[model samples]
Target: MEKFEFTKPELEETEGILNHLRDTINDTLKPDDELRLREQLMKAIEEGHIQRDVFGLNPVLQALRTAQIAVDEIGLKRDGVLATLLFPLVINGHQTVDDIENKFGTSVAHIIQGLVKIHNLYEKNPIIESENFRNLLISFSEDMRVILIMIADRVNLMRQIRDTEATEAKKEVSEEASYLYAPLAHKLGLYQLKSELEDLSLKYLEHDAYYMIKDALNATKTSRDAYIKSFIGPIEEHLTAAGLKFHMKGRTKSIHSIWQKMKKQKCNFEGIYDLFAIRIILDAPVEKEKMQCWQAYSIVTDMYQPNPKRLRDWLSVPKSNGYESLHITVLGPENKWVEVQIRTNRMDEIAEHGLAAHWRYKGIKSEGGIDEWLANIRSALENNDDLQLMDQFKMDLYEDEVYVFTPKGDLLKFPKGATILDFAYHIHSNIGNTCVGGKINGKAVSLREQLHSGDTVEILTQSNQKPKQDWLNIVKSSKAKAKIRLALKETRAKDGLYAKELLERRFKNKKIEIEESLMSHVIKKLGYKETSDFYKDIAEERLDTNTVIERYVELRDHDSGVRQAESAENFEYESPNEQFTRKNDDVLVIDRNLKGIDYKLAQCCHPIYGDDVFGFVTVSGGITIHRRNCPNAPELRKRFGYRIVKAKWDGKGSSQYAITLRIIGNDDIGIVSNISNIISKEDKLTMRSINIDSHDGLFSGNVVLMIDDNSKLDALIKKLRTVKGVKQIIRI
Candidate 1:
């Protein structure tokens, strides 16, 4: 590689950036370290360790600009800035890990290594989708600082790509930024970077929409400023009179945000009313911060009519990523809604200058989920459980959350809609497995009770209690749901083993050598679709031991032709080759090889022909066929897992399934008659029942139909959806 000469402008720009970087990190960068940084960087540049991007931008200048962004914007210190500046050399293979570790400290080297690893993964321009998203998190989730640097570089790239001619490449980069980087920025509390990334992404992807919103804001700037002034004037005076020191400013919402509102509400740009917000940052001591913020909030609300639902109180409990503020919306001048944010200067610094600054501050050891997740990562790294780490990251990345308290007043946070069972599992898996119920604020509540913020709960546990399949539906947190599923699997395995032992004992007691294939044939003869199903029934003592053994002997002897010859006419052997039929005499072609097994269709979800279906063996009622996507399938599979089996319709038969459809539509005169007419006109379809209810000009009804196959049902549904007055129709 040939080394390129530095132009005069490049050197001048480098000199300015070097001065800025040194001043920013002056306290931490010693004299010797500063000299080493300048020397090593110049050496790398001279060694041809850099190349210009496709836009033909200078790599050294770009690296310096990225470092400046990290320091000035993200509040990254000496190590962070140095790693950002030196990462390019490693990427170009001019600098090795050992060299970096020796030149800088271990921290800088580790950071650069993470950066290089991510760069290698990004060489193919991979956008992290569902298949690869978890891998991204597990590999780099522990290196959050590295991810932040990557985000900063992406922000710079998006900024510089505006006039570039790489159309397709730019679009791919923009989509990746929107899908991954912007969301990570929001999660990390980088509001400024998050907004910039989003706006730029919109600018590239939806160019016309972005400029439209931007131009609209510019057009209304004069009137909007006047409105903001009118709203803030009295509030500023009121705050000064109350002896509070504060500065107030107003800003319009981001263009991307405005675009999202337009799409979400199905409205035009003019329909957006709350386009701007006023923020009041108070200068107060650490101890008096919350008090002063609340006082300002009161003063603002006293002057304006505040919307109760729009209030968000984060001062009481800060966000997981260390965001603290009180936000409220109120009706300002011209009866227009305006958002107000209240926070102290310290809080504003954390929100603006850096998200990690608050946690890195001297006295703060708390960053609720980050700290917990970091600990989880350390253990996961040791155990090498990539999937578990993925689950852990997913659990913590939920944006909307609910915070609750234990009896000891320890605050715990969970995803919104989390139940008391989730709380118990979060406390401990053993406690969750044995949790019977809980007491919320001195009132006894079931485990299914949804938790609310600030509610103190005490879990009640019993020794005999165990996790049930229904618990999966009760808990909303991923952790609790995962634990319940694992426990159910383990329980099923243990039961299967115990049942195997018991059956072996019975066979030994009878002095009968067990024949594996013959026993399997006997199990199917008893209508068990799975070998485990047979063992499960025997283990639960649902089947009589003597009766099962005698049947096995009869089937075995009959198979050998001795019992068949003894009584050819009166032989009671239930042949395994018997065709499937219901006791009600509804003949269906179920298993092709079977001749006389009793089975019935599940009424909950009618298993029609050409539909995906499965079989579940019943205790005394033989086999029950059900649709694979049946509403009750998850619970049945979780609890009675061993009883589940695979079943398919071998061919069409003389059987009709009763299916129900719930229809909602306009309560027009005789609208129900139209729906009935459509169903009646279809060939081989019969309306079994029609229950209709009408109110407030809308009608909802359940109509039962007898159909032979899924295709007919689907055709009927499509025809019903086309009805004039029908709004929606779905099968139940």
Candidate 2:
């Protein structure tokens, strides 16, 4: 390949750039590294190319320069390699020189975010993911720079491949370019890169097919030129006569596209006359360009019959990526179907360059409008779940889009097939969660209903509605799903808390001394969102008091014996030898008083002794001890607070304790009677609770029992949570 020779003026510009680079590097680099960088630059100049792209990222070479110097002098962190990638942005600064650093910082922050997104690709390939827009949004949320850098890298690599060795390696790169990178380039509005990527992808993936197409074109070179001339003659004459300034050029579609057309439609070469399209570049104001193009279109249709269905009015509704061109297939001289695309120069540039070119020319707004394109990048950064974040990028940022509308006529672009739930969420998360119904074009609709282009949706939401777990199955957008899941989890927590509070009040009213932590544990066990919610459930008879007491007793039986202190002096904890006794009435009596320490039951695992137990002291929420059998106990032990308390059931006499038992048995007429009779006769307690439910030939009965502490409760639970013919028994 021939090297590009720099003209005198260009060389002067290059010299200025070099001087700027020198000054910036001098200021930014350490003294020792500066000398080494100069040497590297001198060597690079001698070799030509300067080891830099147009953007001047000579990172690997710079690293060598940096490493040759003492690390302490430069004081660069290993991960700070991202800074090198951001250097190009520094030179193009606005206002104060501080703006340089600020933009540099912003760009570096975005680049680091992009790197994080790129790391996500290792977990799942975004191209193959179902939710392209979600994935795209996730990527964008991290940093739009990631997508831009990826585009730049891929383009540079393609150019390199075209002029380098290792054909097989190029082919692999080309295949990836075709399948993933090219489409991305197209979406980004990088027209030149998009075409080059497509051509390169085709060059390798279907070498034989590409060569055949090339050969066909070469063979028809004379006739092809003649055909285009003949075809454009009338249109040109009419436009010239009308005093319109327009440029027309014939463009053959890429080899890959032709191959795809043949494969997809099962057509031969001759059948694809419209494979080569003529582009009419109108020289006019942006507003008048489309009108002039349409008038030209009318003339062309009049001159030759056009395929009406094949005509695409992109000027009216541009692609989400900002590709705008009017396409129409018209009959040619030999009755051949010829395609024509009409657009203004601006539209053409946008069609080629996507969002980057727009940003370069128009500049992004402060609030970051739709054109900002980095909104998705920010979201990816905010996401902590690696897999989900990656998935979000693939779905929201990378996918093809459908432009819909709000009832008020605002354009809402969403991934294709976005559900109404997604639409609601796109408007706002609160709207999505409370959305019980929606309407497309004034028709009431289900939340799961898929949306289409031009659909004007009105979401109907209830003020008091809460998110349901079932919504996770139907909501399309990951944003909506994530939000719903979060809301549901929160609601359950609040409900659990409410239930706990209600149980505590009941204990107080009954003059029954209750462990505050134990009560909280019971509420958490019930999956309530808060202590208040737990109380509400209890007040509404959704929670039984006896079951709560039995659960507390069981928790005492297993975990009442010990507490442990942390070795870290900063972390204050009680020694495991310390013991706390609670009466059956629920009053906590510490046998060994420990200073600045309190214990409570963890709601996560309402620690019933038979269930397994552990204690955690929350700073203000109080100490929460969970049953060892409690699902959350293990997790609470691992993270956050780790204070545990030694406790025992030292309550005197036959103290009645509440315990809930689930009985699963064969559905029968006398099941309730038999269970009630046993409870009434075998125990000294009356029926405090009885709930019978039958499903799939199984009768599951919940029975609340009053027993003498944990030992008797455990024996009864052993008989209940695991009754004969019982599929499963669980303490509620």
Candidate 3:
């Protein structure tokens, strides 16, 4: 790449950033190391064009400035600082991995390479895909400092997005930041960055909402400031008299959060009352941090009446993201609700910067707390064995979490909507496989029961109660789903082996060698796509033994001197009248008196009772009922005109017809139960079974039902369609 000369203003800005970087790294980096890094960074800058400015700073300078922020604010080490400075060069395609490693030693080069890979992966794949998202995290896992640097980079990007000219591109960046990066930041406990990213994203993605909130805040700034000041006055006096050293500041809710509240509460900006919060940062000794926090809490609550339900004491048990604080919403001056937060200086740092500050302040490696969270993510990525990978990963990312305890008082964390089955799997795969149900707080609950925080759970299991394929649809955790799939696969493999052995033995007794060619023919005749499927069907007794034997014998005979013409003369066929008279327990009884018309539901349209349907007589399968508007209906009506039979529901048949319905909705806890309750409440309807598949917050399922008439079925569907969260319902 050709080097471009820096303009006068660009040069001044670059120098200023470089000076700031030096000041930030003054105490951390060794003299020789600092000199080498400075030289390398200057060389890289000289050899590349200042293509763009990020937040009014040149890209190269912005990277250095970000590195400085990581060092001073986030406490990244020397290697992290060096890597951040060089990452922009690698990302912009101005430098190669080999060039970086040869010039900047192995460690710095490795970090740069990891950052570059993450950047490229984000560019190539949608962030919503679990595989790509997991890969992004895995890349960061290699070097924890890479996460810090990325956070810094995002902070700078969010700061600069307002200057982006292209509306579409800006919106795209905002959405990604809001959905992916912001959540990641929150997970890491980087509350400051998370809030900024969310606010900036909202500014672009929902410009009108953002400005409306912003303007509302500005209009009330004077009054809010006065309220905060008045509210803090008594608390300040109490703390001062008690000999406590502290500083208090008023904080306003972020634009994004305010917008979220409006949407969730279905209220306008004016309806939002607790828009401003008060923070009291105490300079407490390390050993007395907890005690001091409580003392401060007492002082504040004593001055103002506190809402017991609104109190959150993270000081007793910090959040998983390493945030520690005491929060209370109190009745403030003028009878307004004022939110108050109390934390020590150290706790405040961790609350702002998250895990990075936690490590820096504690003087410990950033592994123990964050590693547990990362391990969960890594396991999800490594063990994903199904098509629901994206959904499972997203559930981990976006869902609120609940912490529950075992009978032994051991704490476990799960997603908010996780059921007892998920808790079982979290205990052990064997436990999950054998789980029948469980007790929540000594009260028996179904396996599908959604657990709440602080519940004491005891799983009930039986050796004979093995994991069913349907369990995959019931559990909410990736671990539970993965274990179920593995168990099902193993069971199928064993059954397939037994089936193959049995078939081979039968073939041997018949004086026939089951060659690969013969097996292929058998699979085709059995209407199976794979040999394994054929064996599995046989093992499950889904394929009739006599049918398999007869088909194999006919195939063998035809391969030899015997032909179809010779077999036709010897073949005994049942009369159409005899076949038509065979009773089916769950078949649709076509017209009131037309009881003996043999028919099968057409797979093409899967006609249900409520569907407008007609029967078509076929040469082999007596009659096939299809929905009137089925894709195959028009052709069947035109080509098989004579075979078409006019059919209508008599609405008085005693027998019930099996029908399948497709349902889609927003995934929520107890959604299946809600749907089931609706079906079970109807007097004439019986639900045969249901299978649900969900990912993210969306669920799609198939419900099999037995109904007597089209009108009743239609009424049932109408009731189901009205259920909360139900988006679409149709006969499948």
Candidate achieving the largest lDDT: 1
Residue 593, model 1: lDDT of: 61
lDDT of 3 by residue, 94-201 (tens): 678788788767878888878887777867864344345557656766766666677778777767668667677677667778766677677667778888889998
What tens digits encode model 1's per-residue C-alpha lDDT throughout 597-693?
Answer: 8787776677787888778766444787878777767755654544556677876645677888999986655678888889889988899999877
Candidate 3, which segments miss by more than 4 Å at Cα?
1-3, 30-57, 92-94, 358-693, 696-732
lDDT of each: 0.77, 0.59, 0.74
Clashing pairs in 3: none
Instruction: Give the poorly placed runs of model 1, Cα more than 4 Å off.
Output: 1-8, 130-135, 138-143, 359-526, 529-732
**RMSD (Cα, Å) of candidate 1?**
15.7
In candidate 3, how many Å is residue 613 off? 17
Ranking according to lDDT, highest score first: 1, 3, 2
Error of 3 at 444 (Å): 32
Alpha carbon lDDT of residue 392, candidate 1? 38
Better of 2 and 3 by TM-score: 3
- Candidate scoring better on TM-score of 1 and 2: 1
Tens digit of per-residue lDDT, candidate 2, span 358-470: 54345332223333444432332455343343333335433256667887889877766678888888888889878988988777888878776556789999999878766
Angstrom error at residue 711, model 3: 30
